[model samples]
Target: MRVLVIGTSGYVGSAVAQRLSAAGHQVVALIRPDRGKRARRYEWRIGDLTDPDSLTAAVTGDIDAVIHAGTPTGDATVDATAVAALTSRLRGTGRTFVYTSGVWVLGATGTATADENSPVNPIPIVGCRPDIESQVLDFAGVGIRTAVIRPGIVHGHGGGIPALLVDLARKHGAPVVVANASVRWPMVHVDDLAALFGVVIEQAPAGTIWHGVSENAVPVRELAIAAGQAAGVGGEPQVWPLSQAQAELGASFADALALDQSVSGHAARDRLGWRTEHPDAVPDLREGSYR
Candidate 1:
């Protein structure tokens, strides 16, 4: 399949593009002009998602599918505008469009594990996503094969959400959390999540929703210990009051971090045979690249 992957320079995008290429797909990376010196590995197309013209041009010509993994810049309008533009271009095109959402959209699931059918109660930062996801899914009825992927906390290679804890561990000799230490975070390896993109692009039907989570849930305190140990801190995790966390990391992110969630990816595993090779995230965070 000929695939167009946006956000090629980002952590998730780079991994997804590489995995698709390794899987023998003709991967075209849509990169920003400022991040020059294009990678020679895949066919590179320069464009910005926020720019309607660039998004239209990027979707034009011949392309089998598009993976919209690019992240928002904290401005919901910019993200919504991009989705509107992309949906407009792909409407009635009979092409595959994979949109990236996150498990945070399910909000605090408490003890219950969220599934594909779970209701979305997004946090403040991603509050705009439910509406945008609806808009993208609407294209499925208009001849576009649209799929929404809700990934859990993506952790690997000492990057992603774990990096925040690791950085704090290095600075303060312990990992930190907001308000409560028992909040649960669902996690997925970057490589495993990338593989799901390949499966959905090739086999998913229109309006499919896939959760790219491996571990159903892990406590913030446990992750903090792992992060601190990996960073050579090896101490009890520190707690930040919600107000302090909000002041430091912004209310949206702080509230998101405090959410207790457990999510299942059984649909992806059963439907597409996605088996996570790196499921034990604590060990990885403590001894692997993050160490």
Candidate 2:
């Protein structure tokens, strides 16, 4: 398969690109002009998701699949626009389009575990995703193989959110955790999530959703403690008031941190035989990849 991977230079997209290429698929990476120098065996096409012409160039007929791992910023509409554009380009191509969503869309799962069929109560930060998810899933009605991957907190290899937590732990005696100590958040290793992307593009049926979670959930305080320990600080976390966190990191990010969620990716595991290589996120945070 010839796969065009959006956000190739980003944390998740880079791993997706590498995984696809290693699996013997022809990879086309859509990256910014400044990042083009890092392009190697996989073809690199200079483009931005917000630019229509660039999107057109990147989504050519030769591409068999699209793994959209791009993260949306404050401009919530950009992602929806990009998805619309990609949808138009892929309309009747019978190609696979795997869009990345997040578990935050499910919001605080509380005591229950959310599956693919879980009702969404997205946080204010990712409030715009449900519409986009609906749009992408609707592509199947047009004869396109589209799947939405809702990943948990993506962490691994000293990058993603864990890195930020580690930095915070190093600077302060303990890391700052949004909300109270009991709030739980779902998490996934980057490598494992990337592998699931590969599985979805390769075998998942159209109009479906998959959660990229390895461990079901981890408490925020526990995660902060692991981060603190990793950064040579004691395993104690300072609670950041929601208002304060929102003021500092914006409402969306802070709200995301405050969500208490537990989710299952058992559908992917049972349906596709998806095996998670790294199941324990805390050990990874303390001494494995994050260190």
Candidate 3:
């Protein structure tokens, strides 16, 4: 399969493009015109998500599938338009289209675990994402093999949000938790999430949604402590009041970090044989990548 992948310059998309190439698929990475022409294992095509013409031009007929793992442009209309432009070119071609969304769309799940079928209560940080998801899934009806993957807080390779905890610990002499000590987040290692993307691209039924979480609910306080260990700091993590965090990190993003959610990815495991090689994120933060 000749797969055209957007966002290859990003963390998740880079991992995904590598996995697809290793699995014997030809990967054509869509990148910005201004990006350096560094040699990569996969093919490169000039494009940008904000520019619909570039997106349309990049999806030539030889491409068998597309995985949209790009960061949103922060404008709902532009993002939606980008999706439309990409999918419109693939309409009636029976090519696959996979959109990357995040678990934050489920918002605060409290005690009960949310699944792919759970109703979405998105936080403000992901405003209009659910609507965009709906738009992508609707393409399945028009002969496009469209699917959506909602990944958990992605961590690994010494990057992502966990690195922030380590940075904060090094700066403040202690780790910091955004809200109360008990707030939780679902998580997935970047490589493991990439494997799931490969599976969905090859075998998912049209219009299906999958949760790419490995651990359903990891306590943020514990993660902060682990981050502190990685940073050579000691004692419990300091709690940053939500208001204070919002003032620094912006209200919507801070509120998202404080949300307590437990999301299950068992559907992918049971149905697609997607096993998570890295089961615990705490160790990765304390002794693995973040260290």
Q: Who wins the lDDT comparison? A: 3
Model 2 TM-score, all chains together: 0.94
Which candidate, 1 or 2, has the higher TM-score? 1
Taking all chains together, the TM-score of candidate 3 against the true structure is: 0.98
Question: Ten residues in a row with the worst lDDT in model 2?
Answer: 33-42
Report every candidate's CA lDDT: 0.87, 0.84, 0.92
lDDT of 2: 0.84
Given candidate 1, what's the lDDT at residue 278? 73
Q: Which sections of candidate 3 miss by over 4 Å?
A: 36-38
How many clashes show up in model 3?
A: 0
Model 2 lDDT, residue 45, Cα: 78
Residue 256 accuracy (lDDT) in model 1:
87
Residue 154 of candidate 1: its Cα lDDT?
Answer: 90
Provide the RMSD of all predictions against the true structure, rounded to 1 decimal.
1.5, 1.7, 1.0
Ranking by lDDT: 3, 1, 2
